[model samples]
Target: WVQKSLDVTFEEAVALRQAYLHRYGTTLGGLTAEHQVDVDDYLAFVHDIPIERYVRPNPRLAAMLSAIPLCKAVFTNATSEHAWRVLRALDVADRLEWVVGIREVDFNNKPRLEAYQRLLAFLHAQGPDCILVEDRVVNLRPGKRLGMTTVLVDATPEEEVDFAVGDVLEVGPLVARLLEAQND
Candidate 1:
């Protein structure tokens, strides 16, 4: 669906996808900027998948999110519709204060400076006080550069991140400690 939407062969799509990420931060950004692809059509086509089949509801995750006392929101490269579906499926939609997706920032995705700036502006937030927890190390770079504390939710440790955890279970305590330190 993505290849057809982009009007490119599979191999061409793969190459262009990489090139797009390198240049425009997201395939949607590059396609719209360079090829004039319709943003709505592209997003709908690419995200038309069985989300429920992949995402199972987790009560533990919901409980963990409820335990955290900070204002929470989702910042994602996916469309808001997609984000909502996944969040709902996970049973954590209500816990979040905001959902910032690619559509919200005019198709700009993460690792892009403008997208980060727009997100912080939209949230009325400052960079230094924000904490970005993400699985991708590449995505954490921009947040770190903007002075946001970066948390890497990956298996291995990253020197660039302020904190690294193997999974979501470790996040609550680490965040609590950080918040406590700030209070002191």
Candidate 2:
């Protein structure tokens, strides 16, 4: 798909995608800017993941999220529909209150200030009120800079977040601990 869309060989497509990532923070952003690709069409085509094959309904995760009273949302560069599909597949669609996608921020993606600014404004919440949970250190940087208590999922200890968890299941306990600490 990437090779055909970029009109290049597989190897070339990989390199081009990397270049775009470095230049635009996202291949979608670069494709839209340089190739004039339609955002909706490109996203739909690229993000058509077979969620069921890779992700089964996680009842444990659903239970954990339900136990937490925080206002949950998925802040992603992917389309809202894609996020929704993943959440539903995980049986946690009802857990999140919002799916902040690229369209929601007018295509300003993560690791960018405008994207976070726009999303926070939409939620009527400031950075301190948000606890950003992400796997990537780069994505968590902005969240930290904006005063969010970042949680790095499936990662080793890092400077980017306040908490680092080896698995998503640990997040519930971590959040509960944080709340307890705050009350203390």
Candidate RMSDs in Å, in order, are 1.7, 1.4
Pick the lDDT winner: 2
Report the Cα lDDT for residue 132, model 2. Answer: 91
- List pairs with backbone clashes in candidate 1: none
For model 1, where is the 10-residue window of minimal lDDT? 1-10
Residue 62, model 1: lDDT of: 93
**TM-score for predicted model 2 compared with the true structure:** 0.93
> What's the lDDT for candidate 1?
0.86
lDDT against the true structure, each candidate: 0.86, 0.87
The pairs that clash in candidate 2 are none
lDDT by residue (tens digit), candidate 2, 31-132? 877886767778878888798889889999999999887999988999888899999999999998999999999999887888889889878999999999
Using TM-score, give the best candidate's number. 2
Model 2 ranges off by over 4 Å: none
